[model samples]
Target: MQSSHVDITKKSAYVDAHIHLDTYSGAAQAAIIQLLEDDTLPLDYVVAVSMGLKSSQATQAWARRYPQRVLPAYGFHPEQALPTDAEVAELLAWMDVHQAEMAAVGEVGLPYYEREAAAKQGNVFSREPYVELLEQFVQRAAAWNKPIVLHAVYDDAPLVCDLLERHNVRKAHFHWFKGDADTVERMAANGYFISFTPDITYEEDIQALARRYPITQVMTETDGPWPFEGEFTGTVTVPTMVRDVAAYWARLQRITEQEAAVLLRENARCCYGY
Candidate 1:
């Protein structure tokens, strides 16, 4: 978990707008958190999003331990089996109790990968329940007036957008987004933010997105513990990887890498309010 020894002084500082810090091992988490104290790195803060109640608790603890660097977000990820009614209630109640500490309600959205896999296996995937669950989280985010970090993409993006619109929740960050032109236009028009991961460095589709989407509504993330290909094939994914992401994004947007870094960092700060 050592820092990627890239020289970042040439680039403007940036933030990992979305990451799952709790998913890393204890030692890896320690090493990563320790790097945040190093001023030489371009990394400023990491928005650590949670997977569930236990994950949220661990994220909160990390935030407490490193108050200046870790910005914790609490919510259940939608890729797994649905929680029971009591479990859902418990998570909601716990989130309410720690609402003041959370940077946003996040890692929440409809399950695209899971659904696709089920369909490929000739199984009927029930989406209504997932939609209902996302609605509950959206309602809470609206009530708390907190920004929301989402895992929504493709076909699920429009449905999630509907819930956001219904609840009048505008501060939405769609992490690692991939969707059609119309959905992109809708999200951009609504002023919702989307973050690019290291894959942007080599993925033509992601690069195309960086060009089509408004630069002002964009940010950078690692989604660490989720490896990448291309130039990052063997390296441990870290926050500093965003520097390269920003560099590639700048090339696409016809801007300086430093300028892209600043824009992306500000966009994240504006959306997450950290």
Candidate 2:
């Protein structure tokens, strides 16, 4: 027996923190997409992110097509190979072309997990050039004045932070944060918000991190398409399951579900500049 491709689906009435809807879908219909709402929670919204230069525009289009329910962020994903400056330049041009429609700059950062594992897969991922490319996008974002969604962890977090600080780009959000205590504390002090997923429900380290961090600085996310199974053998994910993330955080903070929901939404708004 073998585990089939993950059938990542959203549960009832939840918000997916991060996802690439373009993965399974294509760019053709990406422009006129209709974001469906979970029947259980029709009022909830989902944040869709672009994987790289290829998909940013379509992601933006999806968000534009459904502004009230979708928040779209654009950028290059670092785990994959770096794209040419010409490609990045085109993306920036696209940004200029549709500045009013973008949600934020995101899905970009050093690939601590994937890049390191590239050795086993016989691939290449040097940090110098990729970092430089990321810096260029960061500068463009700063010039445009939009919040950035980051995909860095641990050591990469500091470098990303340093670059952001040097560039004076203040609105930075670290998704799925798993950096050092000192780094987390520093990020918190700098007013950088870190979001959690359902992983917090089972991961002791995540629970500990949530307990120490200020609720005001902490937020919940689904990171949908990536399900987290706590005690269950194999669980699945969807936007609606974000409520579980909120509940877990609330439980860790000794707060009510309602209060957690309000705070999470506020934190998300603050992070994404919504």
The per-candidate count of clashes, in order, stands at 0, 9
lDDT of 1 by residue, 117-204 (tens): 9999999999999999999999989999999999999999999999999999989999999999999999999999999999998889
Q: Which candidate comes out best when scored by lDDT?
A: 1
- After aligning candidate 1 to the native by TM-score, how far in Å is the CA of 123 from where it should be? 1.2
- Per-residue accuracy of model 2 over 1-274 as CA lDDT, tens digit each: 1112221242223355576665534432232143353334533566777877668877776677667577888888887866777887887777678766666788888878876798779988678887887897688668878878889898899999888888888777788889898898888788887878878889999889888876766666766556467652365455556777888787877766666676677666666665
Look at candidate 2 and give me any clashing residue pairs: 9-237, 9-238, 10-238, 10-239, 11-238, 13-240, 14-239, 14-240, 17-222
How high is the CA lDDT of each candidate model? 0.88, 0.72
Best model per TM-score: 1
